[model samples]
Target: MNGRRTIGFLLLIGLVLWGCSGVHPTSNAVWIAQPEFSEVDNRLYSARIAPQKGESPYFSFFLLTLTNKSSVDLVVDWNASQYLFNGKPQGVMVFEGIDPEAVKNAMVPLDTVAPGASFSLEIMPMRLIAWSPIKEKTAAARSISPGMLPIGENGILLALRHGNGHITIPLSVRISREGLP
Candidate 1:
């Protein structure tokens, strides 16, 4: 009986530890359902953005997938990419040398997406001073500048120039103390 109790206690402790690891086993990671798609110059472009695993409040990272559904190839200029917060443009943050392997793999080489193919990339926007819902509510109380508040109902806009046209996708991200989903 004592041995069985010990085993049960150990199993309970193991379960607790797994839950605290942040990486939920059951796909608990938040994700966006409907990706934004637009047609420009007879080419279809779709984009999906989501928070990186174990995202931080100080600096948030996002995973992006750009798909090309048209018969023609498309090129994306990463240098010209912009992130708009609440209809206002914010500074773009470059990962530089600290980029992880997964992030590197996600980066589009030459910013090109072949016909009927897709490119995965990682984008880190400017420093988000108030990402958590609780922090958002207490931002004024904490004296954080209003401009630094996280993008809310206005939604985040990702604009990328492709060839002679441009593709703008609006992403509605829900951020909480836990993380963006």
Candidate 2:
């Protein structure tokens, strides 16, 4: 009985530790691109790109900060915005809206930026997930060869639509393994 009790205790402890070791996705990834600030229509816009924590290597997050300098509310259509990665256009994924709690503070609501206020927009790339064997085969057939992109030397472009016009910001990211730029 004593030996059985000790074994059960050790098993419980192991299970607890294993559960704790599971990765909980966070937004604390290394910023590959420094924040780039731009001023348009008296409003300030800043953008940056970073790899999301606990996600695939290709998965990234584009963060946008918009500050309303004008005395009037600024309307932004985040859903209609576009992102270009190294000249390749990418579609925005709607995962955040599907599971808001999973993303935590990383999820940003699309709404009006009140006068003298600011708002953030987080964007993720669309990824195709195969659910069935046939779908898996189809996806594999259509998938392009996986390759490593030199993110350090690539350029990222973000086009965000505002009330009247759109703001285009180009981010030139230079990264080094030794340190961040």
Q: Candidate 2, clashing residue pairs?
A: none
lDDT of 1 at 79: 43
- Which ranges of candidate 1 are over 4 A from the true structure? 1-43, 55-59, 96-110, 128-156, 178-181
lDDT for position 11 in model 2: 100
Worst 10 residues of 1 by lDDT: 32-41
Query: In model 2, how large is the Cα lDDT of residue 121?
Result: 51
Quickly count the clashes in candidate 2: 0
Score candidate 1 by lDDT: 0.51
lDDT of 1 by residue, 29-139 (tens): 333222222222334777766655343332155566778877676676544455555556654433323233333354533467888888776555534422333445452
Which tens-of-lDDT digit does each residue in 120-176 have in candidate 2? Answer: 654444432222333444534522221222354333455555557776655434432
TM, every model: 0.47, 0.44
